[model samples]
Target: MLVTERTLAREIAPAVERSLPGVEVLAVEMLSPSRFCVYVDHPEGVDHALCARVTQLLDDYRASYTIDVSSPGVERPLRKPAHFRAAVGQEVQIRTATPLAGKKRFRGAVVAADERHLRLAAGDEAVDIPYEAIVRGNLIDEGQVQP
Candidate 1:
Protein backbone atom coordinates (compact mmCIF):
# COMPACT_ATOMS: atom_id res chain seq x y z
CA MET A 1 0.00 0.00 0.00
CA LEU A 2 1.12 3.59 -0.63
CA VAL A 3 0.59 5.40 2.62
CA THR A 4 1.29 9.11 2.66
CA GLU A 5 3.61 10.44 5.35
CA ARG A 6 0.83 12.34 7.07
CA THR A 7 -1.35 9.25 7.00
CA LEU A 8 1.41 7.29 8.71
CA ALA A 9 1.78 10.05 11.29
CA ARG A 10 -1.94 10.09 12.01
CA GLU A 11 -1.94 6.37 12.56
CA ILE A 12 1.06 6.43 14.89
CA ALA A 13 0.34 9.54 16.97
CA PRO A 14 -2.69 8.33 18.89
CA ALA A 15 -1.35 4.83 19.14
CA VAL A 16 1.74 6.06 20.96
CA GLU A 17 -0.16 8.50 23.18
CA ARG A 18 -2.77 5.89 24.15
CA SER A 19 -0.20 3.22 24.92
CA LEU A 20 2.21 5.51 26.81
CA PRO A 21 0.48 8.22 28.76
CA GLY A 22 2.10 11.67 28.62
CA VAL A 23 3.98 10.73 25.48
CA GLU A 24 3.11 12.94 22.53
CA VAL A 25 3.95 11.87 19.03
CA LEU A 26 5.36 15.10 17.64
CA ALA A 27 5.87 14.01 14.04
CA VAL A 28 6.30 10.90 11.99
CA GLU A 29 8.58 11.23 8.93
CA MET A 30 8.79 8.85 6.05
CA LEU A 31 12.46 9.35 5.20
CA SER A 32 12.21 6.77 2.45
CA PRO A 33 9.78 4.11 1.40
CA SER A 34 11.15 1.78 4.05
CA ARG A 35 12.49 4.20 6.63
CA PHE A 36 10.38 6.15 9.09
CA CYS A 37 11.22 8.40 11.99
CA VAL A 38 8.91 9.12 14.92
CA TYR A 39 9.47 12.25 16.97
CA VAL A 40 8.10 12.06 20.52
CA ASP A 41 8.18 14.01 23.75
CA HIS A 42 6.87 14.13 27.33
CA PRO A 43 6.47 16.74 30.07
CA GLU A 44 9.62 15.47 31.80
CA GLY A 45 11.45 15.48 28.46
CA VAL A 46 12.60 12.58 26.37
CA ASP A 47 15.40 10.15 27.09
CA HIS A 48 17.03 7.07 25.64
CA ALA A 49 14.78 4.90 27.77
CA LEU A 50 11.72 6.66 26.42
CA CYS A 51 12.80 6.23 22.81
CA ALA A 52 13.48 2.55 23.48
CA ARG A 53 10.06 2.18 25.03
CA VAL A 54 8.38 3.85 22.08
CA THR A 55 10.36 1.67 19.74
CA GLN A 56 9.19 -1.38 21.62
CA LEU A 57 5.60 -0.25 21.54
CA LEU A 58 5.86 0.21 17.79
CA ASP A 59 7.39 -3.19 17.17
CA ASP A 60 4.76 -3.99 14.57
CA TYR A 61 6.14 -1.33 12.19
CA ARG A 62 9.53 -3.00 12.07
CA ALA A 63 8.16 -5.52 9.62
CA SER A 64 7.41 -2.73 7.14
CA TYR A 65 9.85 0.08 7.89
CA THR A 66 12.94 0.98 9.87
CA ILE A 67 11.47 2.93 12.77
CA ASP A 68 13.49 5.47 14.66
CA VAL A 69 11.87 6.93 17.77
CA SER A 70 13.43 10.31 18.45
CA SER A 71 13.40 13.47 20.51
CA PRO A 72 12.52 16.82 18.91
CA GLY A 73 15.91 18.46 18.77
CA VAL A 74 16.87 22.02 17.80
CA GLU A 75 15.07 21.75 14.45
CA ARG A 76 11.60 20.25 14.61
CA PRO A 77 9.13 19.34 11.93
CA LEU A 78 5.80 21.18 11.82
CA ARG A 79 3.19 18.67 10.73
CA LYS A 80 -0.13 19.94 12.04
CA PRO A 81 -2.09 23.10 12.73
CA ALA A 82 -1.14 22.91 16.40
CA HIS A 83 2.53 22.76 15.51
CA PHE A 84 2.27 25.94 13.45
CA ARG A 85 0.13 27.69 16.05
CA ALA A 86 2.59 26.88 18.81
CA ALA A 87 5.47 28.12 16.69
CA VAL A 88 4.08 31.59 16.29
CA GLY A 89 6.85 34.21 16.57
CA GLN A 90 9.38 31.46 15.85
CA GLU A 91 11.50 31.28 12.70
CA VAL A 92 10.78 28.48 10.28
CA GLN A 93 11.72 27.15 6.85
CA ILE A 94 9.20 25.50 4.59
CA ARG A 95 9.03 23.95 1.15
CA THR A 96 5.87 23.68 -0.86
CA ALA A 97 4.98 20.95 -3.26
CA THR A 98 4.61 23.60 -5.97
CA PRO A 99 5.82 27.15 -6.22
CA LEU A 100 3.84 29.91 -4.59
CA ALA A 101 4.42 33.38 -5.99
CA GLY A 102 7.11 31.69 -8.05
CA LYS A 103 8.85 30.43 -4.92
CA LYS A 104 8.99 26.90 -3.65
CA ARG A 105 10.73 27.75 -0.38
CA PHE A 106 10.20 30.26 2.43
CA ARG A 107 11.84 31.24 5.69
CA GLY A 108 10.53 33.66 8.24
CA ALA A 109 8.91 34.16 11.62
CA VAL A 110 5.51 32.53 11.93
CA VAL A 111 3.11 35.46 12.17
CA ALA A 112 -0.22 33.67 12.04
CA ALA A 113 -1.75 30.25 11.58
CA ASP A 114 -5.18 28.70 11.19
CA GLU A 115 -6.40 25.28 10.11
CA ARG A 116 -6.04 26.25 6.46
CA HIS A 117 -2.81 28.21 6.25
CA LEU A 118 0.17 29.79 8.02
CA ARG A 119 1.34 33.34 7.45
CA LEU A 120 4.99 34.29 7.71
CA ALA A 121 6.92 37.52 7.78
CA ALA A 122 9.83 37.04 5.44
CA GLY A 123 11.95 40.10 5.02
CA ASP A 124 9.61 42.70 3.52
CA GLU A 125 6.98 40.22 2.43
CA ALA A 126 4.07 38.59 4.20
CA VAL A 127 3.67 35.12 2.75
CA ASP A 128 0.65 32.93 3.36
CA ILE A 129 1.15 29.25 2.64
CA PRO A 130 -1.60 26.70 2.61
CA TYR A 131 -0.98 23.63 4.73
CA GLU A 132 -1.97 21.31 1.91
CA ALA A 133 0.75 22.81 -0.28
CA ILE A 134 3.50 22.25 2.25
CA VAL A 135 5.85 19.46 1.31
CA ARG A 136 7.98 20.08 4.37
CA GLY A 137 7.74 22.73 7.09
CA ASN A 138 10.13 22.93 10.01
CA LEU A 139 10.99 25.26 12.83
CA ILE A 140 14.65 26.09 12.32
CA ASP A 141 15.66 27.21 15.78
CA GLU A 142 16.23 26.01 19.31
CA GLY A 143 12.92 24.18 19.16
CA GLN A 144 10.70 24.87 22.17
CA VAL A 145 7.03 24.65 21.22
CA GLN A 146 5.05 23.73 24.36
CA PRO A 147 5.10 19.98 24.50
Candidate 2:
Protein backbone atom coordinates (compact mmCIF):
# COMPACT_ATOMS: atom_id res chain seq x y z
CA MET A 1 0.00 0.00 0.00
CA LEU A 2 1.19 3.46 -0.85
CA VAL A 3 1.90 5.63 2.18
CA THR A 4 0.18 9.00 2.11
CA GLU A 5 0.29 12.08 4.26
CA ARG A 6 -3.29 11.63 5.40
CA THR A 7 -2.71 8.03 6.38
CA LEU A 8 0.48 8.92 8.17
CA ALA A 9 -1.21 11.81 9.96
CA ARG A 10 -3.96 9.55 11.26
CA GLU A 11 -1.49 6.91 12.34
CA ILE A 12 0.98 9.26 13.97
CA ALA A 13 -1.39 11.75 15.57
CA PRO A 14 -2.74 9.46 18.26
CA ALA A 15 0.71 8.37 19.28
CA VAL A 16 1.93 11.95 19.45
CA GLU A 17 -1.08 13.07 21.48
CA ARG A 18 -0.70 10.16 23.88
CA SER A 19 2.87 11.11 24.59
CA LEU A 20 2.39 14.88 24.70
CA PRO A 21 -0.73 16.04 26.43
CA GLY A 22 -2.48 19.05 24.82
CA VAL A 23 -0.37 18.70 21.68
CA GLU A 24 -2.50 18.09 18.62
CA VAL A 25 -1.23 16.96 15.27
CA LEU A 26 -2.91 19.11 12.68
CA ALA A 27 -1.53 17.79 9.45
CA VAL A 28 1.31 15.89 7.82
CA GLU A 29 2.63 16.55 4.33
CA MET A 30 5.12 14.81 2.12
CA LEU A 31 7.52 17.48 0.90
CA SER A 32 9.58 14.98 -1.09
CA PRO A 33 10.31 11.28 -1.24
CA SER A 34 12.73 11.60 1.67
CA ARG A 35 11.21 14.52 3.56
CA PHE A 36 7.95 15.37 5.29
CA CYS A 37 6.44 18.10 7.49
CA VAL A 38 4.47 17.45 10.65
CA TYR A 39 2.29 20.39 11.70
CA VAL A 40 1.59 20.33 15.44
CA ASP A 41 -0.27 22.59 17.87
CA HIS A 42 -0.26 22.86 21.62
CA PRO A 43 -2.65 24.65 23.95
CA GLU A 44 0.31 26.30 25.59
CA GLY A 45 1.66 27.11 22.13
CA VAL A 46 4.49 25.39 20.33
CA ASP A 47 8.09 26.43 20.81
CA HIS A 48 11.51 25.20 19.80
CA ALA A 49 11.58 22.80 22.72
CA LEU A 50 8.18 21.33 21.91
CA CYS A 51 9.09 20.99 18.25
CA ALA A 52 12.35 19.31 19.14
CA ARG A 53 10.59 16.95 21.51
CA VAL A 54 8.05 15.98 18.86
CA THR A 55 10.93 15.46 16.47
CA GLN A 56 12.49 13.12 18.99
CA LEU A 57 9.22 11.27 19.51
CA LEU A 58 9.02 10.56 15.83
CA ASP A 59 12.68 9.54 15.52
CA ASP A 60 11.81 6.24 13.95
CA TYR A 61 10.76 7.98 10.74
CA ARG A 62 14.18 9.57 10.43
CA ALA A 63 15.60 6.37 8.93
CA SER A 64 13.46 6.82 5.84
CA TYR A 65 12.24 10.42 5.93
CA THR A 66 13.47 13.76 7.19
CA ILE A 67 10.74 14.97 9.53
CA ASP A 68 10.09 18.65 10.01
CA VAL A 69 8.03 19.26 13.11
CA SER A 70 6.36 22.68 13.05
CA SER A 71 3.82 24.92 14.65
CA PRO A 72 0.68 25.49 12.62
CA GLY A 73 1.51 29.20 12.36
CA VAL A 74 -1.10 31.56 10.94
CA GLU A 75 -2.93 29.10 8.75
CA ARG A 76 -3.66 25.93 10.72
CA PRO A 77 -4.98 22.88 8.92
CA LEU A 78 -8.33 21.31 9.82
CA ARG A 79 -8.69 17.55 9.47
CA LYS A 80 -10.75 15.89 12.21
CA PRO A 81 -14.04 16.94 13.81
CA ALA A 82 -12.22 18.42 16.79
CA HIS A 83 -10.24 20.71 14.53
CA PHE A 84 -13.39 22.01 12.88
CA ARG A 85 -15.17 22.31 16.20
CA ALA A 86 -12.47 24.60 17.46
CA ALA A 87 -12.68 26.59 14.23
CA VAL A 88 -16.28 27.61 14.65
CA GLY A 89 -16.83 31.34 14.01
CA GLN A 90 -13.53 31.44 12.15
CA GLU A 91 -13.02 31.90 8.44
CA VAL A 92 -11.83 28.86 6.57
CA GLN A 93 -11.10 27.50 3.12
CA ILE A 94 -12.32 24.03 2.31
CA ARG A 95 -11.78 22.05 -0.85
CA THR A 96 -13.92 19.01 -1.44
CA ALA A 97 -12.99 15.80 -3.21
CA THR A 98 -16.26 15.93 -5.10
CA PRO A 99 -17.90 19.10 -6.29
CA LEU A 100 -20.98 20.25 -4.43
CA ALA A 101 -23.38 22.58 -6.19
CA GLY A 102 -20.94 23.23 -9.03
CA LYS A 103 -18.24 24.25 -6.60
CA LYS A 104 -15.37 22.33 -5.15
CA ARG A 105 -13.99 25.10 -2.97
CA PHE A 106 -15.77 27.01 -0.23
CA ARG A 107 -14.51 29.96 1.77
CA GLY A 108 -16.41 31.32 4.73
CA ALA A 109 -16.87 31.35 8.47
CA VAL A 110 -17.61 28.03 10.08
CA VAL A 111 -21.00 28.23 11.72
CA ALA A 112 -21.41 24.71 12.99
CA ALA A 113 -19.70 21.33 12.93
CA ASP A 114 -20.66 17.82 13.91
CA GLU A 115 -19.20 14.37 13.74
CA ARG A 116 -20.09 13.88 10.07
CA HIS A 117 -20.26 17.41 8.65
CA LEU A 118 -19.70 21.13 9.02
CA ARG A 119 -21.79 24.13 8.04
CA LEU A 120 -20.09 26.97 6.23
CA ALA A 121 -21.57 30.39 5.63
CA ALA A 122 -20.22 31.01 2.16
CA GLY A 123 -21.47 34.17 0.52
CA ASP A 124 -25.21 34.37 0.84
CA GLU A 125 -25.70 30.66 1.26
CA ALA A 126 -24.79 28.24 3.99
CA VAL A 127 -23.17 25.05 2.77
CA ASP A 128 -23.00 21.71 4.51
CA ILE A 129 -19.87 19.73 3.72
CA PRO A 130 -19.38 16.18 4.81
CA TYR A 131 -16.20 15.47 6.72
CA GLU A 132 -15.29 12.57 4.45
CA ALA A 133 -15.52 14.82 1.39
CA ILE A 134 -12.97 17.34 2.54
CA VAL A 135 -9.80 17.05 0.48
CA ARG A 136 -8.13 19.98 2.22
CA GLY A 137 -9.20 22.54 4.78
CA ASN A 138 -7.40 25.34 6.61
CA LEU A 139 -7.97 28.46 8.66
CA ILE A 140 -8.01 31.80 6.82
CA ASP A 141 -6.08 34.19 9.03
CA GLU A 142 -7.18 37.40 7.28
CA GLY A 143 -4.15 39.33 8.52
CA GLN A 144 -4.62 38.08 12.07
CA VAL A 145 -2.17 35.84 13.92
CA GLN A 146 -3.18 33.04 16.25
CA PRO A 147 -1.63 30.63 18.75
Q: List the residue pairs that clash in candidate 1.
A: none
> What does the lDDT come to for candidate 1?
0.88
- Where is model 1 more than 4 Å wrong at Cα? 1-3, 142-147
How do the predictions measure up, each by TM-score?
0.89, 0.86
After superposition, which runs of candidate 2 have C-alpha atoms over 4 Å from their true positions? 1-3, 144-147
Tens digits of per-residue lDDT for model 1, 30-146: 888899889998999999999999999889889989989899987978878999999999999999888998999988899999999999998899989998888788888654534
**Model 2 global lDDT (CA atoms, 0 to 1):** 0.88
TM-score of 2: 0.86
* Candidate 2 local lDDT, residue 14: 92
**Model 2 residue 104 distance off true place after TM-score fit, in angstroms:** 2.2
Cα lDDT tens digits for candidate 2, 31-62? 87788888999888999999999999999989
